[model samples]
Target: MNHKPLRARRAPEVARAHILAAAETLLAQGGVDAVQMRAVARLAGITDAGVAHHFVDRHGLLTALIAYGGDKLRAMIDATVTDWLESEPDIGVLLAKLAGLYRQGYSGLAVALHAAGWRETGSPVLEKVVEALHAARFTSGVSAPDILHTRLVVAAFHHALATDPLFGTEFRRSAGISGSRDDGAALQLAWWISVTKRALGYDE
Candidate 1:
Protein backbone atom coordinates (compact mmCIF):
# COMPACT_ATOMS: atom_id res chain seq x y z
CA MET A 1 0.00 0.00 0.00
CA ASN A 2 1.33 3.40 -1.00
CA HIS A 3 1.13 5.60 2.10
CA LYS A 4 0.54 9.28 1.64
CA PRO A 5 3.47 11.41 2.77
CA LEU A 6 2.84 13.20 6.06
CA ARG A 7 2.23 16.88 5.52
CA ALA A 8 3.77 19.31 7.97
CA ARG A 9 2.03 22.43 9.15
CA ARG A 10 3.81 25.30 10.93
CA ALA A 11 0.80 26.51 12.82
CA PRO A 12 2.03 27.69 16.22
CA GLU A 13 -1.04 26.35 17.97
CA VAL A 14 -0.50 22.96 16.40
CA ALA A 15 3.13 22.93 17.46
CA ARG A 16 2.23 24.09 20.96
CA ALA A 17 -0.37 21.36 21.12
CA HIS A 18 2.19 18.80 20.07
CA ILE A 19 4.38 19.85 22.95
CA LEU A 20 1.50 19.96 25.43
CA ALA A 21 0.12 16.58 24.35
CA ALA A 22 3.54 15.06 24.78
CA ALA A 23 3.83 16.58 28.22
CA GLU A 24 0.38 15.38 29.21
CA THR A 25 1.13 11.75 28.35
CA LEU A 26 4.38 11.87 30.26
CA LEU A 27 2.71 13.35 33.34
CA ALA A 28 0.01 10.69 33.22
CA GLN A 29 2.58 7.91 33.12
CA GLY A 30 5.21 9.23 35.50
CA GLY A 31 4.17 12.58 36.91
CA VAL A 32 6.17 15.83 36.26
CA ASP A 33 9.73 14.51 36.05
CA ALA A 34 8.73 12.34 33.11
CA VAL A 35 8.10 15.53 31.11
CA GLN A 36 11.57 16.93 30.55
CA MET A 37 11.95 19.29 27.59
CA ARG A 38 14.06 16.95 25.49
CA ALA A 39 11.70 14.08 26.19
CA VAL A 40 8.74 16.31 25.40
CA ALA A 41 10.29 17.37 22.09
CA ARG A 42 11.06 13.82 21.14
CA LEU A 43 7.55 12.75 22.06
CA ALA A 44 6.18 15.72 20.12
CA GLY A 45 8.15 14.56 17.06
CA ILE A 46 10.10 17.82 16.97
CA THR A 47 13.72 18.81 17.57
CA ASP A 48 14.87 19.22 21.17
CA ALA A 49 15.64 22.85 20.52
CA GLY A 50 12.21 23.22 19.02
CA VAL A 51 10.77 22.52 22.42
CA ALA A 52 12.98 25.22 23.95
CA HIS A 53 12.04 27.65 21.21
CA HIS A 54 8.38 27.19 22.09
CA PHE A 55 8.95 27.67 25.82
CA VAL A 56 11.86 29.63 27.28
CA ASP A 57 12.83 27.00 29.85
CA ARG A 58 11.65 24.02 31.81
CA HIS A 59 9.65 26.31 34.10
CA GLY A 60 7.65 27.62 31.16
CA LEU A 61 7.21 24.11 29.94
CA LEU A 62 6.17 22.97 33.39
CA THR A 63 3.64 25.77 33.58
CA ALA A 64 2.29 24.68 30.25
CA LEU A 65 2.15 21.12 31.46
CA ILE A 66 0.16 22.21 34.51
CA ALA A 67 -2.16 24.25 32.35
CA TYR A 68 -2.64 21.37 29.97
CA GLY A 69 -3.48 19.07 32.82
CA GLY A 70 -6.03 21.55 34.14
CA ASP A 71 -7.58 21.79 30.69
CA LYS A 72 -7.71 18.02 30.46
CA LEU A 73 -9.38 17.76 33.87
CA ARG A 74 -11.96 20.35 32.87
CA ALA A 75 -12.77 18.46 29.72
CA MET A 76 -13.04 15.22 31.62
CA ILE A 77 -15.44 16.85 34.10
CA ASP A 78 -17.53 18.22 31.22
CA ALA A 79 -17.81 14.77 29.75
CA THR A 80 -18.87 13.47 33.14
CA VAL A 81 -21.56 16.11 33.24
CA THR A 82 -23.03 14.71 30.05
CA ASP A 83 -22.85 11.19 31.37
CA TRP A 84 -24.68 12.03 34.63
CA LEU A 85 -27.39 13.76 32.63
CA GLU A 86 -27.89 10.50 30.79
CA SER A 87 -29.34 8.51 33.73
CA GLU A 88 -30.84 8.75 37.18
CA PRO A 89 -27.80 8.35 39.40
CA ASP A 90 -28.54 8.55 43.13
CA ILE A 91 -26.08 9.79 45.72
CA GLY A 92 -24.56 6.37 46.28
CA VAL A 93 -24.39 5.71 42.58
CA LEU A 94 -22.97 9.20 42.13
CA LEU A 95 -20.28 8.50 44.72
CA ALA A 96 -19.35 5.35 42.89
CA LYS A 97 -19.11 7.24 39.65
CA LEU A 98 -16.96 9.97 41.25
CA ALA A 99 -14.66 7.41 42.79
CA GLY A 100 -14.19 5.90 39.39
CA LEU A 101 -13.49 9.32 37.84
CA TYR A 102 -10.77 10.33 40.30
CA ARG A 103 -9.17 7.07 39.27
CA GLN A 104 -9.09 8.12 35.59
CA GLY A 105 -9.83 11.81 35.30
CA TYR A 106 -7.32 14.60 36.05
CA SER A 107 -7.61 14.68 39.87
CA GLY A 108 -3.98 13.73 40.44
CA LEU A 109 -2.86 16.23 37.89
CA ALA A 110 -5.24 18.81 39.29
CA VAL A 111 -3.94 18.21 42.78
CA ALA A 112 -0.38 18.50 41.50
CA LEU A 113 -1.26 21.67 39.66
CA HIS A 114 -2.87 23.13 42.77
CA ALA A 115 0.33 22.48 44.62
CA ALA A 116 2.14 24.41 41.91
CA GLY A 117 -0.44 27.13 41.23
CA TRP A 118 -3.37 28.18 43.41
CA ARG A 119 -5.30 29.55 40.47
CA GLU A 120 -8.31 27.30 39.97
CA THR A 121 -9.25 25.72 36.66
CA GLY A 122 -10.64 22.27 37.31
CA SER A 123 -12.22 23.14 40.65
CA PRO A 124 -14.15 25.98 39.12
CA VAL A 125 -14.94 23.59 36.36
CA LEU A 126 -16.13 21.18 39.02
CA GLU A 127 -18.08 23.93 40.79
CA LYS A 128 -19.70 24.88 37.53
CA VAL A 129 -20.31 21.21 37.04
CA VAL A 130 -21.95 21.23 40.46
CA GLU A 131 -23.90 24.32 39.54
CA ALA A 132 -25.26 22.79 36.37
CA LEU A 133 -26.39 19.79 38.39
CA HIS A 134 -28.76 21.76 40.64
CA ALA A 135 -31.74 21.07 38.38
CA ALA A 136 -31.50 17.44 39.38
CA ARG A 137 -32.15 18.10 43.08
CA PHE A 138 -35.29 20.04 42.09
CA THR A 139 -33.28 23.26 42.36
CA SER A 140 -29.93 24.68 41.25
CA GLY A 141 -28.07 24.81 44.52
CA VAL A 142 -24.78 23.19 45.47
CA SER A 143 -24.59 22.66 49.20
CA ALA A 144 -22.73 20.25 51.44
CA PRO A 145 -25.42 17.60 51.90
CA ASP A 146 -26.72 18.29 48.43
CA ILE A 147 -23.39 17.00 47.34
CA LEU A 148 -23.84 13.74 49.26
CA HIS A 149 -26.75 14.28 51.69
CA THR A 150 -25.00 11.90 54.03
CA ARG A 151 -21.50 11.80 55.40
CA LEU A 152 -21.48 8.02 55.07
CA VAL A 153 -21.58 8.32 51.29
CA VAL A 154 -19.01 11.08 51.41
CA ALA A 155 -16.89 8.73 53.50
CA ALA A 156 -17.13 6.17 50.74
CA PHE A 157 -16.03 8.87 48.31
CA HIS A 158 -13.06 10.18 50.33
CA HIS A 159 -12.02 6.62 50.92
CA ALA A 160 -11.78 6.26 47.21
CA LEU A 161 -9.82 9.50 46.87
CA ALA A 162 -7.43 8.88 49.76
CA THR A 163 -7.40 5.19 48.94
CA ASP A 164 -8.92 4.48 52.33
CA PRO A 165 -6.01 5.70 54.37
CA LEU A 166 -6.01 4.64 58.01
CA PHE A 167 -8.17 7.06 60.01
CA GLY A 168 -9.72 4.80 62.64
CA THR A 169 -13.16 5.21 61.13
CA GLU A 170 -15.61 2.32 60.71
CA PHE A 171 -16.61 3.37 57.18
CA ARG A 172 -12.95 3.42 56.33
CA ARG A 173 -12.66 -0.04 57.83
CA SER A 174 -15.55 -1.51 55.87
CA ALA A 175 -14.87 0.44 52.67
CA GLY A 176 -11.34 -0.81 52.37
CA ILE A 177 -10.29 -2.20 49.03
CA SER A 178 -6.79 -3.33 48.37
CA GLY A 179 -5.47 -0.04 47.10
CA SER A 180 -4.85 0.02 43.37
CA ARG A 181 -2.83 2.25 41.05
CA ASP A 182 -6.04 3.36 39.38
CA ASP A 183 -7.87 4.19 42.62
CA GLY A 184 -7.65 7.95 42.23
CA ALA A 185 -8.78 7.79 38.64
CA ALA A 186 -11.80 5.72 39.64
CA LEU A 187 -12.70 8.26 42.33
CA GLN A 188 -12.66 11.09 39.82
CA LEU A 189 -15.12 9.33 37.53
CA ALA A 190 -17.43 8.67 40.45
CA TRP A 191 -17.17 12.29 41.62
CA TRP A 192 -18.40 13.59 38.30
CA ILE A 193 -21.25 11.14 38.22
CA SER A 194 -22.34 12.47 41.61
CA VAL A 195 -21.93 16.11 40.65
CA THR A 196 -24.08 15.97 37.54
CA LYS A 197 -26.67 13.60 38.94
CA ARG A 198 -27.18 15.82 41.95
CA ALA A 199 -27.36 18.92 39.78
CA LEU A 200 -30.02 17.49 37.48
CA GLY A 201 -32.23 16.06 40.27
CA TYR A 202 -32.04 12.58 38.78
CA ASP A 203 -30.72 11.49 42.14
CA GLU A 204 -33.88 12.69 43.86
Candidate 2:
Protein backbone atom coordinates (compact mmCIF):
# COMPACT_ATOMS: atom_id res chain seq x y z
CA MET A 1 0.00 0.00 0.00
CA ASN A 2 2.97 2.31 0.46
CA HIS A 3 4.74 1.70 -2.86
CA LYS A 4 4.56 3.34 -6.24
CA PRO A 5 3.27 1.52 -9.29
CA LEU A 6 6.07 0.14 -11.41
CA ARG A 7 7.06 2.40 -14.23
CA ALA A 8 8.69 1.47 -17.55
CA ARG A 9 11.85 1.26 -15.50
CA ARG A 10 12.76 1.70 -11.85
CA ALA A 11 15.79 1.18 -9.70
CA PRO A 12 16.29 -2.56 -9.27
CA GLU A 13 16.90 -2.28 -5.53
CA VAL A 14 13.86 -0.07 -5.07
CA ALA A 15 11.69 -2.44 -7.07
CA ARG A 16 12.84 -5.42 -5.04
CA ALA A 17 12.06 -3.60 -1.81
CA HIS A 18 8.51 -2.87 -2.95
CA ILE A 19 7.98 -6.47 -3.97
CA LEU A 20 9.31 -7.74 -0.65
CA ALA A 21 7.07 -5.33 1.22
CA ALA A 22 4.10 -6.69 -0.66
CA ALA A 23 5.19 -10.22 0.03
CA GLU A 24 5.42 -9.43 3.72
CA THR A 25 1.89 -8.02 3.77
CA LEU A 26 0.51 -11.08 2.07
CA LEU A 27 2.52 -13.35 4.33
CA ALA A 28 1.12 -11.66 7.42
CA GLN A 29 -2.42 -11.68 6.05
CA GLY A 30 -2.50 -15.21 4.68
CA GLY A 31 0.70 -16.90 5.81
CA VAL A 32 3.39 -18.35 3.52
CA ASP A 33 0.79 -20.05 1.36
CA ALA A 34 -0.63 -16.71 0.33
CA VAL A 35 2.61 -15.24 -0.99
CA GLN A 36 2.56 -16.39 -4.60
CA MET A 37 4.74 -14.57 -7.12
CA ARG A 38 1.77 -13.31 -9.09
CA ALA A 39 0.04 -12.08 -5.93
CA VAL A 40 3.18 -10.21 -4.91
CA ALA A 41 3.49 -8.69 -8.38
CA ARG A 42 -0.12 -7.59 -8.34
CA LEU A 43 0.28 -6.04 -4.93
CA ALA A 44 3.55 -4.37 -5.92
CA GLY A 45 2.12 -3.09 -9.19
CA ILE A 46 4.55 -5.07 -11.28
CA THR A 47 4.30 -8.02 -13.64
CA ASP A 48 4.71 -11.57 -12.39
CA ALA A 49 7.72 -11.90 -14.62
CA GLY A 50 9.18 -8.74 -13.13
CA VAL A 51 9.00 -10.22 -9.68
CA ALA A 52 10.38 -13.50 -10.94
CA HIS A 53 13.34 -11.64 -12.39
CA HIS A 54 14.17 -10.35 -8.92
CA PHE A 55 13.41 -13.59 -7.10
CA VAL A 56 13.75 -16.92 -8.85
CA ASP A 57 10.81 -18.63 -7.16
CA ARG A 58 8.67 -18.80 -4.07
CA HIS A 59 11.48 -20.13 -1.87
CA GLY A 60 13.90 -17.56 -3.21
CA LEU A 61 11.44 -14.76 -2.54
CA LEU A 62 10.86 -16.05 0.97
CA THR A 63 14.59 -16.18 1.59
CA ALA A 64 15.05 -12.67 0.33
CA LEU A 65 12.14 -11.54 2.49
CA ILE A 66 13.81 -13.16 5.47
CA ALA A 67 16.88 -11.08 4.86
CA TYR A 68 14.82 -7.97 4.27
CA GLY A 69 12.94 -8.50 7.53
CA GLY A 70 16.27 -8.92 9.31
CA ASP A 71 17.37 -5.52 8.12
CA LYS A 72 14.11 -3.97 9.32
CA LEU A 73 14.42 -5.71 12.67
CA ARG A 74 17.91 -4.29 13.09
CA ALA A 75 16.65 -0.82 12.30
CA MET A 76 13.81 -1.13 14.80
CA ILE A 77 16.17 -2.39 17.49
CA ASP A 78 18.53 0.51 16.85
CA ALA A 79 15.69 3.00 17.16
CA THR A 80 14.40 1.34 20.31
CA VAL A 81 17.84 1.42 21.91
CA THR A 82 18.25 5.08 21.03
CA ASP A 83 14.90 5.94 22.61
CA TRP A 84 15.72 3.82 25.64
CA LEU A 85 19.01 5.68 26.12
CA GLU A 86 17.42 9.12 25.90
CA SER A 87 14.33 8.46 28.01
CA GLU A 88 15.88 5.96 30.40
CA PRO A 89 12.53 4.21 30.35
CA ASP A 90 11.64 1.58 32.95
CA ILE A 91 12.93 -1.84 31.88
CA GLY A 92 9.49 -3.40 32.25
CA VAL A 93 7.95 -0.74 30.04
CA LEU A 94 10.76 -0.95 27.52
CA LEU A 95 10.61 -4.71 27.34
CA ALA A 96 6.85 -4.61 26.89
CA LYS A 97 7.19 -2.25 23.95
CA LEU A 98 9.86 -4.44 22.41
CA ALA A 99 7.75 -7.55 22.92
CA GLY A 100 4.76 -5.98 21.24
CA LEU A 101 6.88 -4.81 18.36
CA TYR A 102 8.41 -8.24 17.85
CA ARG A 103 5.09 -10.03 18.14
CA GLN A 104 3.39 -7.80 15.62
CA GLY A 105 6.18 -7.02 13.20
CA TYR A 106 8.46 -10.02 13.06
CA SER A 107 7.11 -13.14 14.76
CA GLY A 108 4.89 -14.63 12.06
CA LEU A 109 7.31 -14.02 9.24
CA ALA A 110 10.21 -15.23 11.34
CA VAL A 111 8.36 -18.42 12.22
CA ALA A 112 8.11 -19.40 8.57
CA LEU A 113 11.70 -18.48 7.79
CA HIS A 114 12.95 -20.35 10.83
CA ALA A 115 11.16 -23.43 9.58
CA ALA A 116 12.74 -22.98 6.17
CA GLY A 117 16.19 -22.57 7.67
CA TRP A 118 15.78 -25.83 9.55
CA ARG A 119 14.58 -27.68 6.49
CA GLU A 120 17.48 -26.31 4.48
CA THR A 121 19.86 -27.24 7.33
CA GLY A 122 21.30 -23.70 7.31
CA SER A 123 21.00 -20.26 5.77
CA PRO A 124 23.86 -17.81 5.49
CA VAL A 125 21.70 -14.74 5.57
CA LEU A 126 19.74 -16.03 8.53
CA GLU A 127 22.96 -16.81 10.40
CA LYS A 128 24.29 -13.34 9.76
CA VAL A 129 21.04 -11.77 10.87
CA VAL A 130 21.15 -13.76 14.09
CA GLU A 131 24.76 -12.77 14.72
CA ALA A 132 23.95 -9.15 14.11
CA LEU A 133 21.07 -9.42 16.57
CA HIS A 134 23.36 -10.76 19.30
CA ALA A 135 25.92 -8.08 18.64
CA ALA A 136 23.28 -5.38 18.82
CA ARG A 137 22.13 -6.57 22.24
CA PHE A 138 25.36 -5.82 24.06
CA THR A 139 24.95 -3.16 26.78
CA SER A 140 27.92 -0.85 27.32
CA GLY A 141 28.56 -1.63 30.98
CA VAL A 142 27.39 -5.22 31.07
CA SER A 143 29.97 -7.98 31.44
CA ALA A 144 30.28 -10.72 28.84
CA PRO A 145 28.61 -13.29 31.03
CA ASP A 146 25.78 -10.91 31.79
CA ILE A 147 25.33 -10.11 28.12
CA LEU A 148 25.22 -13.81 27.35
CA HIS A 149 22.56 -14.25 29.99
CA THR A 150 20.61 -11.33 28.60
CA ARG A 151 20.79 -12.91 25.14
CA LEU A 152 19.41 -16.12 26.59
CA VAL A 153 16.53 -14.22 28.10
CA VAL A 154 15.85 -12.42 24.84
CA ALA A 155 16.03 -15.72 22.94
CA ALA A 156 13.44 -17.14 25.28
CA PHE A 157 11.20 -14.17 24.59
CA HIS A 158 11.52 -14.67 20.84
CA HIS A 159 10.94 -18.39 21.15
CA ALA A 160 7.76 -17.72 23.07
CA LEU A 161 6.54 -15.44 20.32
CA ALA A 162 7.20 -18.08 17.70
CA THR A 163 5.60 -20.98 19.56
CA ASP A 164 2.98 -19.63 21.94
CA PRO A 165 0.15 -19.17 19.47
CA LEU A 166 0.26 -22.75 18.25
CA PHE A 167 1.35 -24.60 21.37
CA GLY A 168 0.30 -22.34 24.21
CA THR A 169 -2.66 -24.30 25.50
CA GLU A 170 -0.89 -27.64 25.24
CA PHE A 171 2.21 -26.24 26.94
CA ARG A 172 0.24 -24.67 29.78
CA ARG A 173 -1.84 -27.78 30.25
CA SER A 174 1.25 -29.93 30.48
CA ALA A 175 2.97 -27.50 32.83
CA GLY A 176 -0.16 -27.17 34.98
CA ILE A 177 -0.25 -23.39 34.73
CA SER A 178 -3.71 -22.15 35.64
CA GLY A 179 -4.54 -19.26 33.37
CA SER A 180 -5.38 -18.34 29.81
CA ARG A 181 -2.50 -18.96 27.41
CA ASP A 182 -2.11 -15.27 26.66
CA ASP A 183 -2.00 -14.41 30.34
CA GLY A 184 0.52 -17.11 31.10
CA ALA A 185 2.77 -15.98 28.25
CA ALA A 186 2.59 -12.38 29.42
CA LEU A 187 3.61 -13.38 32.93
CA GLN A 188 6.48 -15.49 31.66
CA LEU A 189 7.75 -12.68 29.43
CA ALA A 190 7.64 -10.21 32.32
CA TRP A 191 9.58 -12.60 34.52
CA TRP A 192 12.24 -13.04 31.82
CA ILE A 193 12.58 -9.31 31.37
CA SER A 194 13.02 -8.85 35.10
CA VAL A 195 15.68 -11.53 35.22
CA THR A 196 17.45 -10.07 32.19
CA LYS A 197 17.54 -6.58 33.70
CA ARG A 198 18.80 -7.94 37.01
CA ALA A 199 21.51 -9.91 35.25
CA LEU A 200 22.60 -6.87 33.27
CA GLY A 201 22.48 -4.62 36.33
CA TYR A 202 20.09 -2.40 34.43
CA ASP A 203 18.79 0.22 36.83
CA GLU A 204 15.05 0.61 36.30
Candidate 3:
Protein backbone atom coordinates (compact mmCIF):
# COMPACT_ATOMS: atom_id res chain seq x y z
CA MET A 1 0.00 0.00 0.00
CA ASN A 2 1.24 3.50 -0.83
CA HIS A 3 1.28 5.19 2.53
CA LYS A 4 0.30 8.85 2.61
CA PRO A 5 2.30 11.31 4.70
CA LEU A 6 0.88 12.37 8.04
CA ARG A 7 -0.97 15.73 8.27
CA ALA A 8 1.90 17.33 10.19
CA ARG A 9 4.20 16.61 7.23
CA ARG A 10 3.15 19.57 5.01
CA ALA A 11 2.48 23.33 4.85
CA PRO A 12 -1.11 24.59 4.65
CA GLU A 13 -1.14 25.44 0.92
CA VAL A 14 0.64 22.22 0.09
CA ALA A 15 -1.74 20.31 2.28
CA ARG A 16 -4.82 21.75 0.53
CA ALA A 17 -3.44 20.95 -2.90
CA HIS A 18 -2.71 17.46 -1.67
CA ILE A 19 -6.34 16.97 -0.70
CA LEU A 20 -7.70 18.21 -4.01
CA ALA A 21 -5.06 16.35 -5.96
CA ALA A 22 -5.71 13.13 -4.07
CA ALA A 23 -9.45 13.44 -4.61
CA GLU A 24 -8.96 14.13 -8.29
CA THR A 25 -6.58 11.20 -8.62
CA LEU A 26 -8.92 8.84 -6.81
CA LEU A 27 -11.82 10.00 -8.94
CA ALA A 28 -9.82 9.31 -12.07
CA GLN A 29 -8.64 5.95 -10.81
CA GLY A 30 -11.91 4.57 -9.51
CA GLY A 31 -14.75 6.98 -10.25
CA VAL A 32 -17.06 8.67 -7.69
CA ASP A 33 -17.01 5.95 -5.09
CA ALA A 34 -13.31 6.45 -4.58
CA VAL A 35 -13.76 10.02 -3.37
CA GLN A 36 -14.04 9.37 0.35
CA MET A 37 -13.36 12.47 2.48
CA ARG A 38 -11.20 10.66 4.97
CA ALA A 39 -9.21 9.05 2.17
CA VAL A 40 -8.64 12.39 0.47
CA ALA A 41 -7.64 14.03 3.71
CA ARG A 42 -5.28 11.22 4.53
CA LEU A 43 -3.74 11.45 1.12
CA ALA A 44 -3.47 15.22 1.46
CA GLY A 45 -1.79 15.24 4.86
CA ILE A 46 -4.80 16.80 6.55
CA THR A 47 -7.59 15.82 8.91
CA ASP A 48 -10.97 14.83 7.49
CA ALA A 49 -12.57 17.93 8.97
CA GLY A 50 -9.92 20.04 7.27
CA VAL A 51 -11.16 18.70 3.99
CA ALA A 52 -14.68 19.47 5.13
CA HIS A 53 -13.68 23.07 5.84
CA HIS A 54 -12.76 23.48 2.19
CA PHE A 55 -15.98 21.76 1.20
CA VAL A 56 -19.30 21.59 3.02
CA ASP A 57 -19.52 17.81 2.80
CA ARG A 58 -19.19 14.98 0.33
CA HIS A 59 -21.67 16.70 -2.00
CA GLY A 60 -19.71 19.93 -1.86
CA LEU A 61 -16.45 18.19 -2.60
CA LEU A 62 -18.04 16.26 -5.43
CA THR A 63 -19.40 19.54 -6.81
CA ALA A 64 -15.95 21.11 -6.91
CA LEU A 65 -14.51 18.00 -8.53
CA ILE A 66 -17.23 18.04 -11.16
CA ALA A 67 -16.40 21.63 -12.04
CA TYR A 68 -12.75 20.76 -12.41
CA GLY A 69 -13.53 17.75 -14.58
CA GLY A 70 -15.88 19.76 -16.81
CA ASP A 71 -13.17 22.29 -17.46
CA LYS A 72 -10.83 19.49 -18.45
CA LEU A 73 -13.34 17.93 -20.82
CA ARG A 74 -14.08 21.25 -22.48
CA ALA A 75 -10.37 21.70 -23.03
CA MET A 76 -10.06 18.18 -24.45
CA ILE A 77 -12.94 18.64 -26.86
CA ASP A 78 -11.60 21.99 -27.98
CA ALA A 79 -8.19 20.48 -28.62
CA THR A 80 -9.73 17.58 -30.51
CA VAL A 81 -11.63 20.04 -32.68
CA THR A 82 -8.45 21.92 -33.49
CA ASP A 83 -6.60 18.70 -34.22
CA TRP A 84 -9.38 17.47 -36.46
CA LEU A 85 -9.47 20.75 -38.37
CA GLU A 86 -5.72 20.87 -38.78
CA SER A 87 -4.91 17.29 -39.71
CA GLU A 88 -8.26 16.22 -41.10
CA PRO A 89 -7.13 12.78 -40.01
CA ASP A 90 -8.68 9.40 -40.74
CA ILE A 91 -12.05 9.05 -39.01
CA GLY A 92 -11.19 5.61 -37.68
CA VAL A 93 -8.21 6.82 -35.66
CA LEU A 94 -10.12 9.84 -34.42
CA LEU A 95 -13.12 7.77 -33.37
CA ALA A 96 -10.96 5.30 -31.49
CA LYS A 97 -9.24 8.04 -29.55
CA LEU A 98 -12.59 9.64 -28.86
CA ALA A 99 -13.94 6.44 -27.33
CA GLY A 100 -10.85 5.92 -25.22
CA LEU A 101 -10.42 9.49 -23.96
CA TYR A 102 -13.99 10.05 -22.82
CA ARG A 103 -14.42 6.51 -21.58
CA GLN A 104 -11.62 6.53 -19.02
CA GLY A 105 -12.54 9.62 -17.03
CA TYR A 106 -14.90 12.14 -18.59
CA SER A 107 -17.92 9.87 -18.42
CA GLY A 108 -17.32 9.27 -14.74
CA LEU A 109 -17.31 13.01 -14.20
CA ALA A 110 -20.51 13.33 -16.16
CA VAL A 111 -22.18 10.58 -14.15
CA ALA A 112 -21.18 12.26 -10.91
CA LEU A 113 -22.54 15.64 -11.98
CA HIS A 114 -25.76 14.10 -13.25
CA ALA A 115 -26.38 12.62 -9.83
CA ALA A 116 -25.48 15.86 -8.04
CA GLY A 117 -27.58 17.91 -10.44
CA TRP A 118 -30.53 15.69 -9.72
CA ARG A 119 -30.14 16.15 -5.96
CA GLU A 120 -29.63 19.88 -6.13
CA THR A 121 -31.13 20.88 -9.44
CA GLY A 122 -31.24 24.56 -8.57
CA SER A 123 -27.54 24.93 -7.83
CA PRO A 124 -26.07 27.79 -9.80
CA VAL A 125 -22.62 26.26 -10.04
CA LEU A 126 -23.86 22.91 -11.32
CA GLU A 127 -26.19 24.69 -13.72
CA LYS A 128 -23.32 26.72 -15.15
CA VAL A 129 -21.10 23.69 -15.51
CA VAL A 130 -23.70 21.80 -17.55
CA GLU A 131 -24.68 24.87 -19.55
CA ALA A 132 -21.03 25.49 -20.38
CA LEU A 133 -20.59 21.88 -21.47
CA HIS A 134 -23.62 22.10 -23.77
CA ALA A 135 -22.58 25.45 -25.15
CA ALA A 136 -19.01 24.35 -25.74
CA ARG A 137 -20.05 21.19 -27.58
CA PHE A 138 -22.86 22.74 -29.59
CA THR A 139 -20.86 25.80 -30.53
CA SER A 140 -18.09 23.70 -31.99
CA GLY A 141 -18.04 23.08 -35.76
CA VAL A 142 -20.41 20.15 -35.39
CA SER A 143 -24.07 21.06 -35.25
CA ALA A 144 -25.88 20.47 -31.98
CA PRO A 145 -27.87 17.45 -33.17
CA ASP A 146 -24.96 15.68 -34.84
CA ILE A 147 -22.71 16.43 -31.87
CA LEU A 148 -25.31 14.74 -29.71
CA HIS A 149 -25.35 11.80 -32.08
CA THR A 150 -21.57 11.55 -31.84
CA ARG A 151 -21.67 11.61 -28.03
CA LEU A 152 -24.32 8.93 -27.99
CA VAL A 153 -22.22 6.77 -30.29
CA VAL A 154 -19.04 7.20 -28.25
CA ALA A 155 -20.73 6.61 -24.88
CA ALA A 156 -22.55 3.54 -26.18
CA PHE A 157 -19.34 2.20 -27.66
CA HIS A 158 -17.34 2.66 -24.45
CA HIS A 159 -19.98 1.23 -22.14
CA ALA A 160 -20.46 -1.86 -24.28
CA LEU A 161 -16.72 -2.41 -24.77
CA ALA A 162 -16.26 -2.26 -20.99
CA THR A 163 -19.04 -4.88 -20.76
CA ASP A 164 -20.97 -2.36 -18.70
CA PRO A 165 -24.17 -4.37 -18.36
CA LEU A 166 -26.52 -1.42 -17.90
CA PHE A 167 -26.15 0.67 -21.05
CA GLY A 168 -28.81 -0.47 -23.54
CA THR A 169 -27.77 1.47 -26.65
CA GLU A 170 -27.39 -0.86 -29.64
CA PHE A 171 -25.44 1.19 -32.17
CA ARG A 172 -22.22 -0.19 -30.74
CA ARG A 173 -23.19 -3.75 -29.78
CA SER A 174 -24.84 -4.33 -33.17
CA ALA A 175 -21.39 -4.48 -34.75
CA GLY A 176 -20.89 -7.80 -32.83
CA ILE A 177 -17.71 -6.30 -31.33
CA SER A 178 -14.82 -8.57 -32.30
CA GLY A 179 -11.03 -8.56 -32.64
CA SER A 180 -9.16 -5.31 -32.02
CA ARG A 181 -10.63 -2.05 -30.75
CA ASP A 182 -9.21 -0.64 -33.98
CA ASP A 183 -11.55 -2.88 -35.90
CA GLY A 184 -14.49 -1.74 -33.81
CA ALA A 185 -13.43 1.87 -34.33
CA ALA A 186 -13.19 1.29 -38.06
CA LEU A 187 -16.73 0.07 -38.01
CA GLN A 188 -17.81 3.19 -36.13
CA LEU A 189 -16.04 5.34 -38.68
CA ALA A 190 -17.88 3.51 -41.45
CA TRP A 191 -21.14 4.36 -39.75
CA TRP A 192 -20.12 8.01 -39.43
CA ILE A 193 -19.04 8.12 -43.07
CA SER A 194 -22.38 6.75 -44.15
CA VAL A 195 -24.13 9.37 -42.10
CA THR A 196 -21.92 12.05 -43.60
CA LYS A 197 -22.45 10.84 -47.15
CA ARG A 198 -26.19 10.80 -46.59
CA ALA A 199 -26.17 14.28 -45.12
CA LEU A 200 -23.82 15.96 -47.62
CA GLY A 201 -25.18 14.68 -50.97
CA TYR A 202 -21.95 12.76 -51.58
CA ASP A 203 -23.96 9.63 -52.23
CA GLU A 204 -26.54 9.55 -55.01
Candidate with maximal TM-score:
2
As for candidate 3, its clashing pairs are none
Judge candidate 1 at residue 126 and give its lDDT: 57
Q: In model 1, which range of ten residues has the least summed lDDT?
A: 164-173
- The CA lDDT at 4 in model 1 is 94
* Model 2 per-residue lDDT tens digits across residues 1-204: 699887577799988999999998987777778889999999998899999999988889988887776667656765665675567545555666667765574666666656546232334323332343344345445445434555565666557656765566687788888887678878777776776566456655
Instruction: Report the lDDT tens digits of candidate 3 across residue range 26-122.
Output: 7766767889999888876668888998787998888777766666665675566556546743444444445555456555555654555523233
How many backbone overlaps does candidate 1 show? 36
Candidate 2: list runs displaced more than 4 Å: 1-9, 118-146, 173-185, 198-204
Candidate 3: residue 14 lDDT (0-100): 66
Q: Estimate the TM-score of every prediction.
A: 0.63, 0.67, 0.54
Candidate 3 worst ten-residue window by lDDT? 120-129
**Candidate 2, after superposition: displacement of residue 140 in Å?**
12
**Residue range 31-127, candidate 1, lDDT tens digits:** 6677788888888888888888888788999888777777776676677667776775444554455545664635555555666673654355555
Cα displacement (angstroms), candidate 1, residue 42, comes to: 1.8
